[model samples]
Target: MGVQLKSSSLSPTVDHILDSRRHNSCLTLDAVPKFACRVKYLNLLLLSAMPGCCFCEGMALSRLLLLVLVAELAAASSDVGFVFDGFTGEANLSLNGYAEVTSEGLLKLTNFTPEMTGHAFYPSPINFKNATDGRPISFSTTFVFAIVPVYPNMSGHGIAFALAPSKELPGSMPSQYLGLFSKSDNGQASNHVVAVELDTVKSVDFADINANHVGIDVNDLKSVNASPVAYFDSREGVLKSLQLISGEPMQVWVDYDGGEMKLGVMVAPLNKPKPQVPLVSFTINLSSIVLDEMYVGMSAATGAATGCHYILGWSFGLNRDAPPLDLSKLPKLPRQGSPTKRSTEVLAIELTLAAIILLLISTAAVILIIRRRKKFAEMHEDWELEYGPHRFSYKDLYRATKGFDEQNLLGVGGFGRVYKGVLPTSKMEIAVKKISHDSKQGMREFISEIVSMGRLRHRNLVQLLGYCRRQGELLLVYDYITNGSLDR
Candidate 1:
């Protein structure tokens, strides 16, 4: 993780204090800091469970530490910044806003089914440290998505990458808000919603500029900077406008530079560069509007004119010369939503239980390995076998049957398989009754065999030479018992 980023919903009170156009809004925070602090601390439990075992876990602590520091820094200096790349659930990532992994390798957001509203955000908070008080850090994000109309050639609303202070919006209108603003906050200046709207349907009320145009929304829905959706055609060294809801995977880039506090977007994949001219460019300062930290993620909605919103992949880079947005390197689309959701506290509990189970399993494994020695009866030096009835060594018996290979298998019994093996010392052939691990009645049968054979001393019947038991693998050594029980 290059830096920590946060994404979430807003409370009514905090929004009022930060909601102003003046360079200063007389802003003060009590709950934001407390919430940020609590969030940062809860994340540490993740590190305790994951002890850097694999590629994913190796960077868990450092990335979480960056989040913790940014949360603290937001309390000290109002400036904060964070970056997220891909929604593939690495680095303690979870779904926040309104999205779920749908189907095998597919991230279906918004309306995967009918009558649905969806907003998905990264669990982390995004805070950019700016050079000036009113300026924001230069940030860029690239998201790959596909918009499929519920009915062919018909789609409503679209998606946006938003920076807000909270993870949820209560009762937000589904049609116009794009699931971005709540019912009380819609059309209100105090909304604190900054987004690059990808409008697909023309609206007189929203002043969409036109259908399929990219527009930057400030505190409200109207676009301060709007442009027809287009992509850089590097092959022709030119620009071309394209329909956003064309039912194909499309890429959109959002870049904000601190020099002028301007934001830019491009509609092309990683193969194409950020064009010299932006699809939409507007000037503004996040420092003036954004709270101490903001949640950054994608939001999409489908109303009566519905479409299925999908996020194939996503990434973000904040502050200090972050790398160019690359869509090629992302993993496959989501297979299914997280078994548990993190926006709620349930995710932490799930991970905690899984970690505990893992620890218990590992401890049991360690104990078993220590106790696994003396596998062969001959390997047990202190055990007496010479006085017994021609006791056989485990390893010698194993070799006589080629490590209990299937070819030497004589027949299948209720408890286990009987394999043909020749005694090493006596050169006498034998049928070994082996108790398998998966046999449901194996333990009961093994006890019966041991008891029944121990009491008998008949020579005419198959003599019980000896028995071996170690780590669930039980074998009864007897005289050449029932040779060739099965032909093949």
Candidate 2:
């Protein structure tokens, strides 16, 4: 029988298409990388023939690339497990019934209500990979889950990780049945469902040893093998039973080999090195339950008293040769009282208002800069008009200094050197102090002399004559002081 992998976005019905040929189905989460698929070539060939179904690029492009990895399942062993990204959201799973992963990260299989039933299935099916002739294949599965009470009160019913003949759990009901079988199929011999039950409440409807126990169900409510869920503490050398509705996530490890199954429960505190001693060990022929390839997932329900059931994290491996699971690698537990969808709305409004305030501040800064530039230009225009007659042309000064010849230079001081030169237009002898271009003090002194001396009238002090500007040099001129201080 050829298994053609299908592309159904989030449909467990990807297995539903084993009955059809040349059909389309979406890929599974981990199944995207395995199985040397010849079916991919077939899918491409079929799409080429049908012009109406051209896959275009857009949001669907990413789906197409992932879907590209879909291929036929080979006749080989199947090993499926979950990563940290497994319980991210509803986006990562193919949920059914009322089952969903809440935004707070809880994988709620069924809400708390009377007669509520929910079934969640992983998108892919597990193959025992032993032989098709009904040979018992040994496998192991580790599950960390919780059964919460409806506040101040515990609930009836429980949850189970099931290996079913098909994806459908037909005739399933709530309570003692645990939503795996119905009243009609309760005691029936032909039911191919093998469930490992974590039951909380006792039921008159079924033979339950206690309110809290782990059971192995084969087509019936009566457990073929059962044990009260307990942890064996090595330090104290005692086995302790746990309250199933304690709200803390409990870890259960199951390993089956050599016609015998072993289960370990760690309820108090789970640490490195799995509990060595098995809490429950029983021998049964899983070969009898194996009628076909099984779909492995969790099923939960509520009846009478209801509590929120969660399948936080789970992993499975086939055969004894596979590597042991590192519980640390499993996805994180759902956080308690995390922000819900309603809180996200409030956050969105706050973000929008902050963005508007930032935009207003940026606009005001740009306007202020432009206004300051305009005011500075108006002040410079007034300064030029007031000092018009006193400022000599740069050309007249350059000619009078003869490109600042050496003989015309008289003396040098902190600011610059004084040069004696005669103006060509009026034959007026002038002493010029050429301020250094890069000197900060020289520029300050030049501005101080202009603003202070130009407005002052003095007879004893040297008269302020004029000034000139070259490329960037500040040239200051004053009546030559010769007879009073120098030997002329």
Q: What is the C-alpha lDDT of each candidate?
A: 0.63, 0.62
TM-score, cand. 2 vs. native: 0.51
- Model 2 RMSD in angstroms: 23.8
Candidate 2: minimum summed lDDT over ten consecutive residues — where?
1-10
- In candidate 1, which residue ranges exceed 4 Å CA deviation? 1-86, 89-98, 112-115, 129-134, 321-326, 329-488
**Over 4 Å off in model 2, which ranges?**
1-86, 90-92, 258-273, 320-488
lDDT of 1 at 63: 71
Please estimate how well model 1 matches the true structure, expressed as its whole-model Cα lDDT. 0.63
Tens digits of per-residue lDDT for model 2 on 344-428? Answer: 5566788899999999999988888887554322212344555777777655665677757889888777878777778889988
- TM-score to native of every candidate shown: 0.50, 0.51
Pairs that clash in candidate 2: 6-25, 6-26, 7-25, 7-26, 8-25, 8-26
